[model samples]
Target chain A: MASMIVTDPSSAAAAVHRLPFARFSNGLISLGRFVGPLHVCSPTTTLPRTLSLRSPRSSRFITASMATEPSAKVIDGKAVAKQIREEIGADVSKLKEAIGVVPGLAVILVGDRKDSATYVRNKKKACESVGINSFEVHLPDDAPEEEVLKFISDFNADPTVHGILVQLPLPSHMNEQNILNAVTIEKDVDGFHPLNIGRLAMRGREPLFVPCTPKGCIELLHRYGVDIKGKRAVVIGRSNIVGMPAALLLQREDATVTIVHSRTKNPEEITRQADIIISAVGQPNMVRGNWIKPGAVIIDVGINPVEDASSPRGYRLVGDVCYEEACEIAAAVTPVPGGVGPMTIAMLLSNTLSSAKRAYNIK
Target chain B: MASMIVTDPSSAAAAVHRLPFARFSNGLISLGRFVGPLHVCSPTTTLPRTLSLRSPRSSRFITASMATEPSAKVIDGKAVAKQIREEIGADVSKLKEAIGVVPGLAVILVGDRKDSATYVRNKKKACESVGINSFEVHLPDDAPEEEVLKFISDFNADPTVHGILVQLPLPSHMNEQNILNAVTIEKDVDGFHPLNIGRLAMRGREPLFVPCTPKGCIELLHRYGVDIKGKRAVVIGRSNIVGMPAALLLQREDATVTIVHSRTKNPEEITRQADIIISAVGQPNMVRGNWIKPGAVIIDVGINPVEDASSPRGYRLVGDVCYEEACEIAAAVTPVPGGVGPMTIAMLLSNTLSSAKRAYNIK
Candidate 1:
């Protein structure tokens, strides 16, 4: 009878340790009788509002092996991104078929940094993939600021272009804010437009496009079933491009988001306590295994080029984390070349598709 | 040797328990030795730039008691605000003296909400106190939207006006965004303008003025030696006025900021882990002592009125936290009326001063 008192394993251990065997058994049986039937029906869950699988389909940009022996579970970014892109592509098709217009994405690339050129190319490819018309306006390295403004004015007046993305790290002399601000907010699909960033930061108002990379990072977490609620998240590097906005995005997700920068004292100690670590510092191997907590989810956004004599290019793409060590300690990890990079372009397409739908008033 | 391990009783027990006892003791002694000798010739301790006092000076509108208590530390809004006003007043004087120009603050107060009127009156008084000429345009409750726009346009073109504030809760019928955005970014002292908000949210860029109340809350924390780096901060409420902006400002301060709104589940459990809690839910006594971590700093921005027959007004101002319980458990807590409310006006004056300085080209 006492042995019957023990119910759950932990409680049973406590009951057995504190009470006589007959008393414990009796308690267990009573507890089991009271709770056993409850498991047959259901655990409470908040039902989805629409029961619609209408989220943007992920687009798989590049396939990288995610399975490892035993240490960490791979968070498959390419697969997730591909699925999102497919969903967005489907929506883009729906909008085009329903309405007479298709979403057009305009890219304004100033100067020719190889990296910037690559991004623009990727964006164009993504646009084509998502059924969005791609428009490119490449200004020379020394184009007049007035010319850029004129282009923006043209796009602002064009009803066909739903989104405009000005490649970042503009020529050193150009006033980036003035140039970015020139884009009509409706077409500022990069979400760099002040109105949109303001809306993203404001409560009750959602941005039409939460900047692609930050959006991608959050999407990765959501698809992976990471519980952001009440979890400590540490974002390293406070670059305008990634870290600061990413922190804001994480805060909206209900994770306590700490942004550690170069000025931060003992960032390692702070980072070690985080359930989630997003490093955008672009410093190779800056986040060591010792800096991470066991079972922490690591998202390395740094795409640093490290010297690799074996490679013909003399450098290979590496991440902020020492990948080998991180894998051993982390519960989940994202690979660099295939992780956040591809997802950003996918999100760009998703945003463009949404912009198209909103412009045409197509559901 | 064992006696050498002298632990300071004031150190948080949690911190002491985490590190080895000997290392903690050795570190303490080393810190003491390092600090003691530096002050022998020069008694003044040099605070780091991060710790520099950016607190606003007191305004002429209201002043609270200057009492220090053990349970709660005064936020000293008056002192901080006074410093800010002095700087602004000086700038205003320079503007007038140099270019036959004076900084003008235009306030648009719509409707006769008693609270709104009081706030407007206080803001006008603040404007005058800082040597800025105050121009007020009051619209009747039933005034047409075009009238408000007309007033905004007038202020926008007025070369004399350096800053503008449109008191909120405009009649339900008016388009708030269109009216607010009418103010030129240079004169948007309240910093609610979309462009200003966008600038605030971006990295490597700053808004001309941050929204006053949130800026004040963050200034209090910065002045009080509470380090935001890597700390868990919970912001209650999600209103554009206070909570959302406060979370953004805190994120800028590098704290792990979590936002809890009406939709959040188990807010108490979330708030309990906060190293710093900013409650602006406008619900009297919504947060109890159990919701706060022991020794956590609290900034209560709520100014709700609860029935109190004992008071002459038949109601008493109560904050989001039950002050009685909060004072006992929290390291520091701001009182309902005297804390954030005064700081807001002070920051407004600070922004006004900044505008005047920029307008007049005064250093």
Candidate 2:
């Protein structure tokens, strides 16, 4: 189970402004975006006395609390993504009017995996929504590896294309490293190139582009006014795409970072000491309430699907952290379905815009 | 006070098989190497019960202990580096006999900085000691940047040169990044290239060459039989050359690694949790006895020079850890002058040999 956010473009549009709310069996209403004065925590409860009001811009709070069980502030990635798209759209328009150039993104999809195809389609739609040009190539499963390289080569020479993305999970016969390396560093919007990662790891150096998922994770933290410097941050998982880069990013922000992987012993003990935790291990409910500090914030990148007999699809999406348990313990948390998923594509658009600006020598 | 071990070639040859020993005023004889103990420890002292017998091959132990203050086993890096050099020398002879190829390393020294010249001379000497061919090119302080690039290009084309190292702290007029990046990744034995670093940071990917100092730190752990897997490791400082790479290397060995930097708050609290600690920050004696966890293995990479009125040179070398304090607390500790210093040049020789083997396609 990989905790990556690859969502359909249509679903992203539909999920906007939807509040994350939970109703308990004890007749208690837990509103994720509730605001205004109301009954705070009961004095007799063992819950932490200090309530963390994270969203200063939104100014939301819990309306009522019948039970002592506390609720975490929802990160609301979908809403945040909506605002970012709007910002990008306005910038795209201004660039077009001033420089008479539209940012262009080129994507190459090798195989016909349903999820991969959906991601490509969503990416193209996202480009269109932000007034950016999108170029795509669909190759048959049996297509030769050279064919994919040819497309990348052509895109590399194309001045109009600012960003290039190769949809992953290439055919087994294809060498992913060779294909990925073929894309020029300037147009590597996906940022999987080792050069970008190397630059990111070193101090006094800047990567041309940060990986989209991790960038979105940091964006959420920045938007929520979370202080990263001098904080203890624990990142679960050591995956090349997400966890490793996320840890590096946190370290760059001056957060003393530790990564917990499968080989880590007593992970909960180390994780509970963190002021902020980023769980990208994809294991559903692996991070329990006890694994988090009382006021710690959680950004759950996992969107794992567990079997659900009552749901129409026979499965329901869950995050690495137990959402119910996290609400009662953490200061804030990102939901599995509507959280990091939408932000991934939004960051892709932003990267494309930035690349175009650099190409045209525009700020 | 950077802990980088830059020594003169003549001095490297002079300092061999030197044992680390400490004389205490408590009438305690602390011998770094004492095979067959006279007395273990007094039963009244508050110390860890389990004694760490690290050197199985050497079968060395503490010779005498008068007071309750227990002494740590010295890592004996000078002896370890000598062993490694002997192994590398034998391998170089075998490869030459088998394939009729001798490994070669090229050193480019810019400017007249005394320290930089000493490091280059040491590297050349070390290469010769290991039966590898050495090439040297010295440029004046005011040499043009193009001259350096020309030398790099020539070496890049030279089949005899398997590894190319450009001495760092190039003149202020030259761009370090551009000059470092000029050397092809294939011959980047110094391993400062972003591509090499990118590979080192990612999982399932291997860098052509690991940086010398950090590689030596890990080699010390492996030689001493210090367990790394499933252990908690802390790395002080985050410099690209040492601290950062050291943390990544520890992570690769399956140790949960945390990096503490200058901006980190309450560094002692985190450092005390590590089973193994590698201090690379140049600050002299910054990590005191209380900062180390009892029974932890310490690898000190800092070789800082502090003022010493009594010394002939008016200075003395110390490490990031307070040596006297660490000896009483840590299970084992590497000494400043003889610890990681000698190992760096040995690893450089090893990298050059490996590069030659790869180039010739020899097993």
Candidate 3:
């Protein structure tokens, strides 16, 4: 029974071989909707006397005609980000005109990794583009943890620095939690502070700043007019930076959110239930067409590198979802490289702008 | 099709008439398995072409004979809490012998609510039973917020006071968030602090303390040897105190957790999918027999006063789950009044003891 449903035959075969039989069976049952015929494939066999009831409207299943035409509205994060930056720039000018103050973002990069350096440079460029001040402190990889803490403390007290972001993947010798905790909650634009997250989780409490990536995902959803309230949302992965917070954000907007992590027994089954799916597991092309509910919104956060002989670079960036397959089945899909990737920095700028507004008591 | 399934025909009729059509239909489709006939009731009609598959093992559905005998193992929270208190007493004596220190809990009561006073008295009695020290400060309802903050500050600085609890529902004039935040994170035995909650939500981080009711729910699961890993668990509430934390705890334990709140369109469907259920919505008998998946574990945190002329007090406490219905369907169930009620203070004492241990650097 588990072997029948396959939107992409090769991927389904691969997945079956990759996952354990129990997990594969559970996942396949949920994928049964992708099969041409809507059979009553009850996944609740383990439970006593439970019947799997299919609604009379099972004709919405993806047919051959629906698969041929790519119809998903692409969520252009790059365009939305540009629009956001312009908005921020306008807000920055207004603030400066009103109170002679410009929002400032502080970046502390401890390591010399090429990727880290590129990210820092991009962030600084983003700040400049948005008419905000950018402050950078590049310390050696082996710099003492105390030095980093001192810089954070200085930034904490600096009135001009509205937001402080510490580039992640600091040297292994440094205590990450200790250093992250040093930034005062007010200046925690990166929103990695436990207090910020705590406030975000609680009802009737507002977080000063939400983490950039998840915040960016929600922003895209809003910009694209995706309904969140009372909808079912599934977040893949449980990383502190992305998956966990994304679920929290979706929940805040009144979604019935379920988080599927590495330990989840049937990720596909759970994910198939979501009206909105946010995949940030860093596993390229893990979410196949069969794993998606037809017309479900997809926010693919993964930016993994896959081999691409045709590209100038040896590898090409791909998201956690199969982009090509998703376009045919989903109502909307965020593309790789240009999707959630660009919106992250935009949210960081937005957070900084809001922080400055908060400091100056601006409406 | 939505009206066929009913464990108790009268209650089902009441539910159908009370709820709106859409919500009732969605809830009833999920409740289909409770009917004598194991018909496939598909809840996915809104979705395009998704088949509702039932496993071949549909014979486990509830039948008349099976419903007569109550077989669920009662999670004796009263007995378990007593055991916990005894264990804490042993630990308190050990800590006192080794460090010449007894754990002390300071509770601040601002109002003259009778229930609040009874709770405080019960807590004090529990602390005494566990060989710990308890300190109480009662303030008038008209007292300034600053006065309460002063007592909290003193408790925070006191070496002997390992735990500080401010009784909730402080005078309406006083800010609850400000007062709750005043208790230092180290001495936040109630675990109501945002930092503690934040730590609890994040992966690879340990909260100094977990909120008592939710912690008690998980402890009951552990004592009864319930397998949480990779299981489907549903938490039926989103309150900051119990429901939210309970879901987080279940997720931490590797359960694929889904939270069904007031806005959830299909609560019964989601609840039926759970291997374990923790309901803290405070709605008496909200979860009926049809909501239970055969052999699922039920932890009902709600203790609501339902009118009962048969009882001397004119009312009897009932849990969110219908107890008789749950016992017939669930493999394990927690009874109201005797269930989670007794475990809250036990967890409070446990937290205070652990706080003292951490303060003294005792293993």
Q: Where does model 2 exceed 4 Å of error?
A: A1-46, A49-69, B1-46, B51-69
Whole-model lDDT, candidate 1? Answer: 0.67
TM-score of chain B of each: 0.76, 0.85, 0.82
- The lowest-lDDT stretch of 10 consecutive residues in candidate 2 chain B is B10-19
DockQ of 2: 0.69
Candidate 3 lDDT at A83 equals: 86
CA shift of B361, model 2, Å: 1.4
TM-score of chain B of 2: 0.85
Query: Model 2's A-chain: what TM-score?
Result: 0.85
Superior by TM-score: candidate 1 or candidate 2: 2
The C-alpha RMSD in Å for every predicted model, in order, reads: 18.7, 9.0, 11.3
lDDT of 2 by residue, A166-202 (tens): 8766889999889988999999987778889999999
Highest lDDT among the candidates is held by which one? Answer: 2
True contacts kept of 2: 0.77
Of 1 and 3, the candidate ranking higher by lDDT? 3
Q: Hey, what RMSD does candidate 1 come out at? A: 18.7
How good is the docking of model 3, by CAPRI class? medium
In candidate 2, what are the lDDT values of residues B130-203, reduced to their tens digit?
89999999999999999999999999999999999887667899998898889999999878687888989998
In what order do the candidates fall by TM-score, top score first? 2, 3, 1
